[model samples]
Target: MSRISVLVVDDSATMRSLIAATLRRDTDIEVVGFANDPLEARDAIKRLNPDVVTLDVEMPNMDGLTFLEKIMRLRPTPVVMVSTLTQAGAEVTLAALEIGAVDCVGKPGAGVTAAEAFGDLAMKVKAAARARVRPLGSAPVVEKREGYSGGDKIVAIGSSTGGVEALLTVISAFPENCPPTVITQHMPATFTKSFAQRLDRASAAHVTEAVEGAPLETGRVYLAPGGHTHLEITSGAHPRCRLVPADPVNGHRPSVDVMFNSAAKHGPRVVAALLTGMGRDGAQGLLALKEKGARTIGQDEASCVVYGMPRAAFELGAVEKQLPLGRIGPAILDLCSAAAPGRDQ
Candidate 1:
């Protein structure tokens, strides 16, 4: 019931003022302190102990990424990155997310108003305040397994808030010949391409931003391109990606619900999982897939950053099984195996 206290960290006075003013607009959020750089930010963090921190991706003296790493290693506080909406900025923001930031929002660029840039900053800060921040450490090492024959089954995953690190953990464990997979991670239009590239670099399976008419082939992972369109799967002997330009579902253009509903048409041939997120976007869609006999999984709460999407789906009886973050990747692969049980079996 208490207000969410926030520390604003940025080298730019303009940005600090803008961020502080924007957050103060929300009745539930209070800007507790400001820091011109990471050194000042460090002292502010120790003194104010704000529930959340809004961090700029690039700052003077100490870069945000290094400071974020130090914070996660030493203190493990919830953070939301404020970044520029450029390709390079996207890469850095993704890095910050992987380093344990709960979420991110872009800075106002040329022709973009401050309001447009930070419209959702307060909401994200609220979510960050509730996030489960993990200390920096070695990721769980998933032992590679053999005997995978994915067949015609397609895999769909949905995530939000802390998805960058979660998705990296999940997808990096995938084998070279993993099943066709599609992901709808909540992100900005400028970020998905870089994220896909990041995923491709980390995982054995090839990952890319989804394009209309692309075949959903084995060993390929399609990430829904954020911003203008929703990624859907078309059913046929050979399934393919479909990008639909429609109104945002669940307040998101690349809504997980749209993707899951589309994949649901494949029935038992589809396998879906909802990972750590901050809303109910994918709950009903996962339930629809379950009703159509698809195998469904949810990331258990202990491993979730926000525990929103998976919790919603689990409550709706959409998840046939729930597993930890480290286990979800292999579990999905197991479900997609050719020898796995189907609707008739």
Candidate 2:
């Protein structure tokens, strides 16, 4: 097979060189070109036609966001954002994801080293290379869920890889009074806080990073904090968010399986969905939910950037329904209506 070609775009010479070296460590990836600014990137993109582009979120002459817009508009391709590990940089990086960049890794900054910077870059670039690119204007419109009833059910969603884009579409469609939702997305500490904030801004429902003992409430969403803790549900008058410190499960802290397995103890009151991700982290836990008569859904392969997780769940007979990415939000809403508090028939 041919090598996975990459174009490294960053204003800092050191950053570009460092990124190139990191990607080169993987035998399958080759550095096709380097661009110091968007203008150079524009020219190099046409010349090199690389499989992936590692783009700096900030640069002189046409910022990365505007340049990313043009890339999505004129030429849709897999792009990964290399953003600074700052609040402003986090905002820009989240916008990049919304604009169709496959994924992002924080640039080396205070509290982040070059070694930590490359932690996910090469793997993300490889995944992005095989990712499907959709034109900027051709995305599915998010239709907010209407006529929602009060639901007693708890919703747990697990995703990675194509998740930032997929979750934007799904969560934004939820009503302001949607069921209590818990999400466990594979992300590093630098990204999750910004991601949760982005979700809060985008969705009508209240969204927050999970705290140690936050009470689960309807109309609110809790995103698991990235790093060392897993999000779990504790039984009570109403389910509450239980953040527990633990080793990585299925190679991820705050793993979907831990959340789902804990929710499984609640029996039929939980509704679980496994979104697009790189591996089989959530499959078994989703099956556990299904076994307890909870409604389980999986994103279909065609709509997934990496079909690994959802495919694993489907093969395991964990998913009661397999729907395209565009349909999952409405499907979840339907499930909520069926099981709403006092409305369950």
Best by lDDT: 1
What lDDT score is found at residue 130 in candidate 1? 90
Query: Per-prediction TM-score, please?
Result: 0.97, 0.94
The candidate 2 region of ten consecutive residues with least summed lDDT is 336-345
Clashing pairs in 2: none
Distance (Å) between predicted and true CA of 46, model 1? 0.9
Candidate 2: segments with Cα more than 4 A from true spot? 143-145, 338-345
**Candidate number of the best TM-score:** 1
- In model 2, what lDDT does residue 239 have? 77
Error of 1 at 258 (Å): 0.3
Give the whole-model CA lDDT for all candidates, comma-separated: 0.91, 0.88
Give the alpha carbon lDDT tens digit for every residue of 57-123 in model 2. 8899989999999999999989999988777887788889888898888878777789887887888
